[model samples]
Target: MDARFLGIPELAEAPSVAVVIDVMRAYTVAAWAFAQGAEKIVLAESLDDALALKARHPDWVALKDGPPAPGFDAVNSPGLLRSVDLGGRTVVQKTTAGTVGALAVKEASLVLCAGFVVAEATARILRSRGCDSVTFVVTGEDGRADEDLACAQYIARRTTETTTDATGFLRRAGASRAATELTEGVRRGAHPDDVALCLELDRFRFAMVATLEDELMVLRPHDVPSPTGTAAA
Candidate 1:
């Protein structure tokens, strides 16, 4: 199997399997939301569409770009989602990177959203499926964020059975410009815990696979089997 680590700009040429990574917050938040019992997440390209969807389905939570709207349940923060009740609830997510990357690579044979949390499971899925080529789409700020790049590298290392300094990778990501921005936001009463959460590696065992359901991108947890033939849910 071959794996290519590219930025979001390379999504035009779809690969056999594309793994969209956004470690700063987007994919991390989605993984936490799913783990917390979110029924489904609908990826919206624009905040207007997200709002419109929220208007149509008032029960669903609308996650916008900036701060959480007054009537909305939560923002795009994994730390915030940790405290909210997402049981059986649907979320409409609109972000600058992760969601956009997932939607853009719809042409891929398989699209999966990943973060540090599910890196190993994602690698397992790729190996299990026997994919010839895998593309890791690092969806960062214009595709240059170090945190996302580090995550892509980590996943690639896991898939290819290579060794990387995991501790060094996390340390570098914590000091990245994106992480610094989020840390600054934390001082202003934003979710301070998200910075630490996003940097934690392999926190979850299930891969979040993106699939189209009724024209909406829905992310669901895919349990990967361990080497011993047991399912890792």
Candidate 2:
């Protein structure tokens, strides 16, 4: 298998399998939403698109980067989702890095979103599916944030059977500009637990896979069986 790492700028013409990583915190929020019983997540490329979808559904939650918009339930924060009820509900998400990177990979055969929460399951799925080539796209804050790159490198090392300094990677990510901004947000009493949640590794066992359904990109959990003869939930 051929696995390569690319930044957000290279997402337009990504490889057959594209793994999008955004650790501080888009995909991390996504995984939490899924764990909280969200039916599926629709990734919108723009705020307008998310609003339009919300207008039609009326009950679905529309999530954006900053403060929550009027009629929207919350912003892109995992900590906020803890108090929200998302049973069998859909979430429309639009973000600066993660969703944009996902939309740009139209040429990829398969697109999977990942953070530290689902990194191991993602790697296991890729290996089980026998993918010949894959590209890890780090959708950083300005197309180059350390947290996203570290998450991508972690997944790459796992899937490629390579050794990497795991502790050092996490330490560098915690010291990154993006991570520092999130920590600042926490200190200011905004989603006080988001920074810590985003940094946790292997918090969830299921990989989130993006698929096109009726022209919309929807993300759902993919269960991959582990070596212990049980599926990762």
Query: Model 1, clash count?
Result: 0
Question: With candidate 1 superimposed using the best TM-score fit, by how many Å does residue 231's alpha carbon deviate from the native?
Answer: 2.0
lDDT digits (tens) for residues 49-150 of candidate 2: 999999999999888887766866678887887677788999999988899888778567889999988888888888788888888888885457888888
Clashing pairs in 1: none
Task: Please write out the lDDT profile of model 1 over residues 1-233, one tens digit for every residue.
Answer: 67777777766677778999998788889988888888788998788888888999999988855675665567788887888888999988888899988988877779989988888888888878878888888888767888988888887777767455577678778999888988887423258888999887878888888888888887777888987898886
* Reference-based TM-score, model 1: 0.93
Over 4 Å off, model 1: 162-165, 186-189
Tally clashes: model 2: 0
127, model 2: CA deviation in Å?
1.2
lDDT of 2 at 158: 82
Best by lDDT: 2
Q: Scored by Cα lDDT, where does model 2 land? A: 0.83
Model 1 weakest 10-residue run by lDDT: 183-192
